[model samples]
Target chain A: MAVDDAVRTALEREVGVEHEELLGEISATLTRRYAAAVGDSDPLYHDAAYAKSLGYANVVAPANFLPGVICWSEGAPYDRLREDGTEADTHLPGVPAKGVRVMGGGEEMHFTRPVVAGTVVSRRTVLLDVTPRDSKQGLMLVARYQDEYVDERGQELLRSVRTVLLR
Target chain B: MTTPSDLRVGSALAAQTNDTSITQVFRYSAATWNTHRIHYDKEYALKEGYPDVLVQSHLHGAFLTKYCTDWAGRAARLTDLSLRVRRFAVAGETLSIAGTVRAVRAGEERRALVDLDLVETRGSDGETCVEASATVEVPRSWIGEGVLP
Candidate 1:
């Protein structure tokens, strides 16, 4: 599971591939709880009547709630997380890096619409781009991944581009 | 005299201040399903050369949104927000985000276009780490009314 030149080459070559993941439905209560945990009291995300007035069945999930959907793959080739809960594997497939740390820079989110409650949302992830960088301390890699959220009717709810620094 | 009519392209807005801690970041991580190693794993974060598990990017973005939406009041809707990362912001660092009115015009039939400069400054070191721009649509009738929007 150690990161090596071979892993970097494989990740670099695998760019532009799309990974589709189906997320289990999180209850509406949990959805609103997430918003509350962030101290967001926006009625559109919590008040059923308010969301119903906006033509929704229940509360709509906040725009930044997409990351709660990643279900870890079982038997994936990546190293199993250690007792310390740290996976020593630096080179994740679709992410290019030989050695160094990976940090999430941020995301650019475009909301075409808000998410509706009671309906399970699906994620369509695509490895958009990959680039290499050199730092004084060590080598660095940048991976751009796009996650698109869709509702039951296949309408695009939101699109997020997650940028991470791979070392 | 800093009303919408007096706003100019180069004019800057007042800064909004906020302090975020690791505890808040942990709560957000638990709530948002963000299992990224760089966010909460100290060993992983240090191995990656970061000072500590850093604040989630979306959380930082949320703070920036709060800065504008709180100022814009209820009569405004953020139409478009676009930002590029200039530097990394870690936990325990209080951030100050500011918005400057860039341009104002009629966007749609009942909406006024309000463009702003979104900036996040580190409260400890006073360094600007993020730069963004956004366009908001504010109702014309929101002014001078105690009830916003």
Candidate 2:
């Protein structure tokens, strides 16, 4: 599918508009599961006692833990999911649910603080920009989204700029 | 094991290797709630011009994350990580991650920062799959003044 006028216009409208969500607290189980899934044997991520000994309140999350998770909540119902199995309501707000393909191009993350297991976190996401380009497959729209994650006291934990390719 | 005190600008960290398997890939997809067909549907991936179901880009990031955290151990904290996916790796390929200390800088009180250049390369053809850089915060006592930036 080509990046038509409607797609460009829809994406342009979302630039700089912030969408906020309370992603909830970081859990030891989820953090451990993510680390295990990646085959990390580091005791700091698996053992709370070890992490506490190193000055952490609980098991510490990996560097990419927050941005690595695709969905933070229970996720949408099957009917609400896009064709590619992504939630239609979050992330790509202005892009249509169907006929457009979306993929993660890359990310730049600044981990300001370690995420402990019990710290409640919230995210503020804003569409940074969208650029149109021609590719062998067709017209591709490279959209950049900036996300900032903070704890309950408003302390920043992480900030990231992610690039998504939509075609 | 490489400790923060022993790290130098040209010091090399230990390499970790992961043998990518279909089961591992599926579990990664399930863990992340990623329903991308290119990561699991072999037939759909074939249509997309890949040899097999390709590993998710985030999964590649996970491997790199593991490598950094494992190297830093408990005494250090990873402060920044930035990476770009240069190529794709299939389910059965082996991916190896390695890092080199690039620089050392003064950080917040009692902490020193170490900069690392990281790479994840496909074992088969030695092609770079992901290129990354990271900043880790370690205790100032762990670093030697000779390596300070």
Candidate 3:
């Protein structure tokens, strides 16, 4: 399935429109689990005392922790899932819930501050742009989404621009 | 660990290797709440043209993230990272990450910002699977003057 006119129109309409979600508080356990999953044994990410010794309030999250997480809340029901097993209600804004295939192309991230346990976080996402390209498989649309993560006090934590390819 | 003062352009960081397994892939998917069948269901992956359950894209990012942070240690902070996946590696493939200092510049509060060009290549075919770059904030005291080459 190639990117058709409707998909292009939908994506174009979402450009610059911000979608907000509360990602909730960061937890030390979750951070540790994420680090363990990545096979990283960095003490700063696992030991609170070690983290504090290094001047952090608590164990710090890995650089890509925020963006690496796919869903923040309990995911949608089975019916709300796309054929590719992605939740239809979040992430990609204007893209249709069905028919289109989505793949992660790449991302550029700026980690402004270390995320520590007990810090409530929120994310504001905006569709940056969409470009049409031809691929061997067929027509592909490269859509870029920019996500800004902040603590409850509105202090920036991390900012990322992620590219998704739609076919 | 390579301190900032000792980090001259073209200096290579120690290489880190990760031997990925199907179980590791499954655990990563569970931890991230990712239900994408291509990461766990070999049959589904085969239908999608992959030989076996494929590694998640974020997992690749995770490995690269670990590489940078592990090298930077506790004091140095990883400020920026960018990654592009050029190829696919299935579960059970050995992935090796290595980096070289590209540039060094001054930063706030007596810190030096080091830029590194990084690459993650698969062991089986020796093809580059992911290309990346990172910026780390390290203490200026650690970076000696005239380090840039």
Candidate 4:
């Protein structure tokens, strides 16, 4: 069998495992930068006074802000990085850290509560399933991961089922 | 505020456009801690057959989210957002988004759920790069008579 197929088999074996991570706090500066980067001038992400007027304790992260954060850790050394410039340990639960290329397919998200600055968040991610397919890029696997985000108090902020394409 | 009177099934929302720049794409990747070189390395993007560094899929989703949130404002909350990237949009491409109301139903308490169908099109070729849907929860008072229970 090809190495890619073998990798798929290994990935398939890890289906149903749960991975959790404490993503630290959502900083106001981070949220502001994200909103600015996206060219979103929404005052809720920038002005605390405006957010307060809206009944929030402080500025709030925009919709999709939680899932948009790709890496939570400080990251590995440069030498440990893949040719694609991504760190293995930071993502892709089952697949080997090297060789495989990963791409974001899409996302289905539900916002249960607003995420405000200074809120420490945690995520429980489960590999819901993985299916192999043949694409224009040749053999690939589509994996769906359901990520549940909660506040320090365990209140659900949001949940998203993210689709990742591995080649 | 996207009041109930503003959300009618089949009614079209105003269109908004964003002229994407390479700087914007790189900044988004950096802010997200996404080290993917395809979003910053022009050479790598060319080797991958793209005209230039491509926009991240999540960026496409963000545009859709902005579209909904900008329209809804503070009076409404975006409860749900789902999107699929249908094509790759290179840097410097203009992304235009517009939505139409799909349905309205009673939500929790005095809130009403407004569903919208959104499409993000690339201005360079008029091709749709992403298709999305959103559910915004708004005050039921904004709904017109007989629109919802």
Q: Pick the candidate with the highest lDDT.
A: 4
Model with the higher DockQ, candidate 1 or 3: 3
| lDDT (Cα, tens digit) per residue for candidate 3, span A1-167 | 55798899989999999999999998999889988888888898899999899788999888888998888898889998877777888778988887777778889999998899889999999999999999877788999999999999999999999988888
In CAPRI terms, where does candidate 3 land?
A: medium
* Candidate 3 clashes between residue pairs 3 or more apart in a chain or in different chains: B4-B143, B5-B142, B5-B143, B5-B144
Candidate number achieving the greatest DockQ relative to the actual structure? 4
Q: What tens digits encode model 1's per-residue C-alpha lDDT throughout B63-99?
A: 7665665566545666566666777778888888878
lDDT of 2 by residue, A1-167 (tens): 55677898899999999998999988899888888877776787899999888888999887788898878878787787766667776667678766677888888999898889999999999999999989889789999999999999999999999889887
Least accurate 10 contiguous residues by lDDT in model 3 chain B: B140-149
Off by over 4 Å in 3: B1-5
- Winner by TM-score between candidate 2 and candidate 1: 2
Q: Can you list each candidate's DockQ?
A: 0.35, 0.71, 0.77, 0.85
lDDT of 4 by residue, B20-61 (tens): 999999999989999988899999888767889999998998
Docking class of 2: medium
For DockQ, candidate 2 versus 4, the one ahead is 4
Candidate 1 CAPRI-style tier: acceptable
Writing each residue's lDDT as its tens digit, candidate 1 over A36-154 gives: 76667789778999989978889877655655333323322344443223344322345432233455666677767656778776778777777767866556667787778787778
Arrange candidates by TM-score, descending: 4, 3, 2, 1
- Candidate 2: where is the Cα deviation over 4 Å? B4-6, B141-145
Q: lDDT tens digits, residues B26-90, model 2? A: 87877777777888989977887889998888888888777877777767888888888888899
- Which structure is stronger by TM-score: 2 or 3? 3
